[model samples]
Target: MARHIYACPLRWSDMDAFGHVNNVVFLRYLEEARIDFMFTQAAEAGAGEFAGGSVVARHEIDYRRPLVHRPEPVTVETRVTRIGGASLTVAYEIKDTAADGTETVYVQASTVVVPYDLAEGRPRRISPVEREFLSRFMDEEVVAV
Candidate 1:
C-alpha cells in the first residue's frame, strides 16, 4: 500500500473575502492532485489510457480547517480506497506538515471516478493495466464512506 503525494500551490485568488481559501477552490486543488496522480503518474506507470477519458462520478469532502494563502505549497496525499469493476474511489488529505512532523489537515475528501470510452461514448470496465497501476497506491485501511 502506498500514497501519492502532490504539492499544491496556493494562489492569492483562492482566498475568499473572509481571508481563507474559498470552499469551491478546494475542489480545484483536489482536481489538480487527482490529475497529477491519475494522469501523469499513472501514464508513467503504463496506465496512460486514464488520461484519455475519466470522469468524476461523485465527491465527498469534509473541510477540516481554514487555510490562508501561503507561498509554500500544501501537501495532498491521495490513496486508493476502493476499486469497483467500472469505478474507483480515491481518498485525499490536503495538509501542511511542520518541521516537527505535525500535520495540519485542511481537508479530507474522496472522489469516485469512472473510466470512459470517449470514442464509444460510454463508461468502461477497469482495464488490467489501469487496475495494476491503481493497486500500487491502494490502502486497505482507508475506506471511504
Candidate 2:
C-alpha cells in the first residue's frame, strides 16, 4: 500500500472552547499530509512529479471522535484513492497514534484535487511524473482500521 504519513504538532490555537480540536482544523491537517506525501514521492520516484498547482474540487470528511490539543504529535495518513483525467482523490485518516492505535480515528477525509495551470487559470492533465507518483496509492483495498 502507498501510505503517506505526516505527524503534526497540535497547536494551542487549534482547540476550541469545548476543549477539543475544532472541526475545521482537521481539513488543514489533511491538506498538509497530502502535500507532504506527493512531495516525498517526487523526491523518491523521480517521476510523476507534480510541478503544477492543485485545487480542491470536492471534500468529504467523517469525524469519528474528538481529540483535545495536547501539543502532541498527531499522524495523518494520506493515500491517493483515485485519479481522473483532470483530478486526483486523496483520502486521509487522522489519528492520535501516540495515545491510541488506528482504531482511535479522530477524523477521516477525502479530497478531490485537480491540476491547474496557474498562469492560464485552466484545468490541466496530470503530468507524467505526478501520475507515476500517484499510481502507487490508487484505489487500494486495504482500509485503515
Candidate 3:
C-alpha cells in the first residue's frame, strides 16, 4: 500500500496552556492530510470520478504522545484502509521528526468519508475509476491504533 504524506506546519496557537499541541488541533492535521490526498493528489491522478465533495461520516483518533511546539513541520501520513460502496476509510499517522532524523508518533487516526452529490443531495457510489484511484493507496491490513 502506498501512503500519501503531508507536512503540516505548527502554529503558535496550536499549543495549549501545557505547552503542547491541544487535543483539538490534531483533527486539523488529519483534515489537512485528507484534503491534500482526496482533493489534490486524487484529483490530479484523475477527475470526473470525484467531482462531488466528500463528507466525513466518522472519525477515530488515538493520541500516543503530546506534541510540543517545534520549528520543523509535522508529518501526516494517510492511506486508504477500506473502500466500500459509498464510503471509504482513511487512516492517518501524525509524527514529529527530530533533528537527528528520528520520528516520534503523536497520534493515529481514521476517517470514514462518503462521497456526496451536492446537486442531488445524496451520497453516491464509488465509481470504478475512483475505486481504482483509491486502491492505489489501500492497505490490506487494518490500522493497529
Candidate 4:
C-alpha cells in the first residue's frame, strides 16, 4: 500500500520549556499532515469535496519519544486504516529516518474523520469517489495507539 508522506517543519515556538516538542503541538502537526493528505492531494485526484467540509470525530495518539526542534523537517507518514460508511480512520507516524535506514518514531496516531455536508449541516457518508481515493492509501497494519 502507498502512504501519503509530508515533510513537516519544526518551529522554534513548537518547543516546550523542557526543550522537546510539546505534546499538544503534535496534534497540530497531525492536522497539518492530514489536511495535506485529505485536502491537497485528494483534491488533485477529484475528491476535492472532502476539502469543503470534514470533522474530526476522534483522535488517538501515542507519544513514543521526545522530539527536539531541529532544522530538518520531520516526516509524517499517513495511511488509511479503516473506511466506514460515514467515517474513515487515518493513521500516522511522525518519525525521522537516518542515513543508515534506522527510523526513530516520535508519535503514532490515528484520527476518525467524518465528511460533512456544509449546506445541509450534518455528517455525510463517504462517496464512491472519496472511498476510491482513500483506498489507494490503505494498509492493514494500523498503529496500535
TM-score of 2: 0.85
lDDT (Cα atoms) of all candidates against the true structure: 0.92, 0.77, 0.86, 0.92
Residue-wise lDDT of candidate 1 within 1-145, one digit each (tens)?
6899999999999999999999999999999999999999999998998899999999999999999998999999999989888999999999999999999999999999999999999999998888888888998742322
| Residue-level error in angstroms, candidate 2, position 60 | 0.2
As for candidate 2, its clashing pairs are 47-129, 48-129, 48-130, 49-129, 49-130
TM-score for all models, in order of appearance: 0.95, 0.85, 0.89, 0.95
Total clashes in model 1, counting residue pairs 3 or more apart in sequence or in different chains: 0
* Runs with alpha carbons beyond 4 Å of true place in candidate 4: 141-145
Candidate 3, 1-145: lDDT as tens digits:
6889999988989999999999999999898888788888778988444546788999999999998887888999898998888888998899967889897899999999999998898888887778888888988843222
Model 2 scores worst on lDDT over the 10 consecutive residues at: 136-145
Best by TM-score: 1
What is candidate 2's lDDT per residue for 1-145, written digit by digit as tens? Answer: 6687789778888988888899999888887786677655565677433545678899999999998878568889887887777788888889866434335788989998888888888888876666767777776642221
Better-scoring candidate (TM-score), 1 or 2: 1
Error in Å for residue 55 of model 4: 0.4
The predicted structure with the larger TM-score, 3 or 4, is 4
- At residue 137, give the lDDT of candidate 4: 97
